[model samples]
Target: MWYSISNLLGFGADFGPTTAAGRLLTIGFWMLSLILIATYTAQLTSFLTLKASKSTITGIDDIKNNKVPHSRIGIVIGTSAEEYFLKTISQGSTNYYHLSTTQDIFIKLLDNSIDVAVASGASAIYAINNLYCKLTLVGEPFYATSIAIDLPRVWQYKQSLDVQILQLTESGELERISAKYFNTLTCGSSSSDESSSKKMEVQSLAGLFLTYACVSVIAILLHLWLKLKRHL
Candidate 1:
């Protein structure tokens, strides 16, 4: 475990496997680590750079500034999001496209009728992660709001729950949880359609597992054979 962690972090290991089979296994592990790290780094960098591009309409501010025409923006009618857009973005004019449901966001986006969609960040993210893998968050959630479980006021465990949630965020468990659901790109376009990158699965490391299994069996068999030789 120490060796694996150190290798991934680029720290020099104090010692390495001495046996031939152990060395072979270590080599395979090194290769796997490199591939995993490279993929993660490349994708992270790509996302960050894309986030900075001016061509992308980022947040509510961009919409208010008319980066996309008001007619091209889709807002779910009768939603607080629509109200906010009307009051803040469109100056009380109902010129923006009225969408019937959150689902209309993706439908309008894909159909080329809308350049932007006004919906809760959570709803948009959920759609992007589960249903519409090609769709994505443009910027930090605007009009950020807190969501909470319905706990009784003066609840004794409230502090404890808050602490636990904060710990999850600080330790990156939240991001890991998010990644588990959001990692796949089943719906893709052109280049991504041809080659969608996915996290390394256990199946991809079958060769390494097979090698270790074979080595363990060989070692056991050799031990038994040596015992028989000594008896003879």
Candidate 2:
């Protein structure tokens, strides 16, 4: 049982099996090895053929330290993103260019008018995946906040609205709605194709193929030796 397990994992025994049961185990080992080899080859081939996208800037620090001028940093007017950057990144200075909408943010980026933009995580990701194919999101989220409905203090339906919102949240309706929008903006198919084309290279899988070739040659030689011994 131990020998079978060890061989199954590709750790061949030093001595040949002498008993019928041991030989059977050895056969099982060979079968497992062949399956593993085939599986690895297929995966390696796919990996070599796929490409990856590379981003120039990875985070807010990159934007801050980048030699790009301050005017190139875009911020949507009257947004939390704008407030956050003004208070934290820009240090109370209004050096960034102002834009009225999220669409304008991506348009400016595509035109090279803005080197970077401060916006909500969801908005940024949506634009990058759905609107601007060339844009990429990088780094961890800087500020964490909740999305909630705001109401005036004297609103008569506030209690009813709160109860309904709570019900939606607890019943998973809100999550489903959010997922619908997220799925639309994921951009999986296009990004995958673009990445596959960019990253894959023949040299990446050379080592895997070399190892497989060496193993195949050894197996062939062993089979020939066994055939000659049977005849003698």
Candidate 3:
């Protein structure tokens, strides 16, 4: 039955269904295969076209292997990211361009002074969202660090502050605040724009559906002819 179904779908299985149920199943299989193949081919073409225009730098490995020219890599001085790159990536070598502030990172990138920049994930995402919509984060975080508030040794209300911080975190307020910053950095609206510009119409799949319908009609006719021949 499986071989007959495969053959009916033009898979060259060299068999035909011996039962009515098998013939019905073959028709269903053909319809399903047609839908799946059409959808996959359309989506794959769209994906490849978009990927070609996107940045080649996906992660830190690409950065390390490409060596993007030391001078072109920008880092804000006195930050954890700067320390990580210096100690781990550059091996204590002063190869990266030092920026005075996080904002400078995007400015230099836009002007083509720097090819890439390393900054705290929060600050980088915030900048990309609010200040520089054109800039994008390339890789997974290399040096993950917890953010903490500094308190003086003699400061009072330390316990109270800790309790409030815990309350905020537990209540999901901290997550909401972080999400507000990072969520805006996504190119969702841009994707919508592309989709709108290249919107698929019913006409786009008309030929595919037409071909399936024709094949279905032919299969039904053949089935009817065989049944009449058997009776004769």
Candidate 4:
């Protein structure tokens, strides 16, 4: 404790070990401190360089609360997103940047024209994972709506279609299909070179910790033996 504190604070620590086990533990402690500091520095550097800035808008609520200017909020003119913004966010006022396509939403986001892009979850995730590596999803969906297929008013196969869809869902086939499409990572994934850089793990220092524990036990035993001899 004293040595680590002194070293970290740039003060000289004169820790003189009176026993061999204590000396061994001192070496282990030194290595442990080194790894801790190295790991901390690596994590800090990664965060400062790779992470997004604080001005990043987190979700629909952030935009609604004016964390970003409403004008900077981009929505495709014909999308459900624009309808949501107009009805729920803008409250019938067209206080948003009307983008004509999904591509424009991302382009404007990158070029600093828009701070928030209102879009469907699946489309946004697909774009981010497949096309825009730099743009990542930050928040939960604005609202969840049920998906349905429009059937004729007097369709005879309606009951059969519903049964088959329910069977697929119950069998987990629907979820598996959804995952196959939406969950495949292609951008800014941890497998990338920058993110894959090695950092300290508990297992990396496990042997050192075990050695220190043994040295601590030996030191305690030696001290007890010495005290007993003096009492005798």
Candidate 5:
């Protein structure tokens, strides 16, 4: 049944479902399968591309200021860096192009389609030293994040995975991977002055919210107190 849907939807060209109902049921499965496949494929490609170009990216801010050329920067769609760069950094750079696979980005870089690439700095470091690409950090770091291994929730494997990941992190394997590609001195530094400004903005916003909430509570309490005194 699912095989028929795969055939009708042009999903699994290699396999076919025997029943019509099975094919219909497969429509949903096929759609989900396609989505997952594309996502995984993009990740795999991105990893390969990052591996190839980690040495060449230079740093995060170069891509923002058009220092790397508008056509040269590579970024994955829907990634946090992509969102931050497009919304906050690459304001006037019309030459920028969005890429899905990191592998494609690196290929483009190698082919001279792009001059710089941005991804997780940690992954960039891993690719740089191990991949042996000729590249260097162009400027300061961009954003920072910690990586964790996600395990299946079935049978309560979270604790085991956490321990294993902690061991890997504590043993310095993670740092070792980072030290290979990135300049150990500034691997995770924020690339732009604006980042500091953003931090200020966030703090200010938090303060404003807290103040407003407190004022609202005080006003409500005062109104209730006045109403009770009148009743008395």
Candidate 6:
């Protein structure tokens, strides 16, 4: 309500809940972590899905350059893709203009504010085949992550659930769901993008070198000006 209060008072304010804000927020993290763990155990993990409202774009290049652009790709915060994008694409900064939550990204795409959403390619294909065929999927997927269901770490009582998941997998029930949703028998292997890391490292070194050179030049100029002033 701080944002509301500030607006009422004619002052700009940010009201993000934080430790300073005194509201509990870790529950979301815990719940998400629990879900991931369950998926891991049951092997029914959720896949990330990228969706776009507009249909004209044809390929990943269009999405990366003309459509989504570096400053406008939307992704779920704290997700695997976000982490990879930061490390490989954004150099570990959380403030990439291209990134946002999956939902907000879709909304942005619908509003024509963003070009595309980055999500599980599997999920994207599913949406395209079953739901949003109007939007075209770009080139081959850039990466893939294993999908799994979250479960508690305890190995005793969850055995029954594990057995059930295995039974479903063997009975082809899980495969049916996969085919229905994913249009494939098995998920594709994740693409290996090592160039991103190498490029980031190179850029970081260049930035450091440039900063050091700039500071050195400034210091030399200042010293020279001070010495001449002393004589004058």
Highest-scoring model, lDDT:
4
| lDDT of the structure predicted as candidate 4 | 0.75
Using TM-score as the yardstick, the better of models 1 and 3 is 3
Q: How does each model score on TM-score?
A: 0.43, 0.56, 0.59, 0.58, 0.43, 0.45
Backbone atom clashes (below 3 Å) for every candidate: 0, 5, 0, 0, 16, 19
Per-residue error for 190 in candidate 6, Å, reads: 22
Candidate 4, residue 29: how far the Cα is off, in Å: 20
Q: Write the per-residue lDDT of candidate 5 for residues 1-232, one digit (tens) a residue.
A: 5554554355465765454433444554555456546755766776566556444445555454456665667777766667667667776343566788656655666777766667654555555534534433456555666555555657577778779878988999877875655545342333331112222235534654565456546655666776788799
Question: How many steric overlaps does candidate 4 have?
Answer: 0
The Cα RMSD of model 5 versus the native structure comes to 27.9
Report lDDT per candidate.
Answer: 0.72, 0.72, 0.74, 0.75, 0.57, 0.53
**Candidate order by decreasing lDDT:** 4, 3, 1, 2, 5, 6
Better of 3 and 5 by TM-score: 3
Lowest lDDT sum, 10 consecutive residues, model 2, at: 191-200
In model 2, how large is the Cα lDDT of residue 28?
51
Model 1 agreement with the true structure over 1-232: per-residue lDDT tens digits: 7886776566648998775555655665666667767867887776666545424676778887788888998988987788788777777999989999888899998888988888864656666756776565566566864556898999999999999999999999988986766454445442342224454568876876676567657755766776788799
Tens-digit lDDT track of model 4 for 198-223: 65678987886787677668767877
Candidate 3 residue-wise lDDT at 209? 67
**Runs in model 2 lying further than 4 Å from the true structure:** 1-53, 150-152, 183-186, 189-193, 198-232
Cα lDDT, model 1, residue 198: 53
Candidate that would win on TM-score: 3
- Pairs in clash, predicted candidate 2: 50-196, 51-195, 51-196, 51-199, 52-199
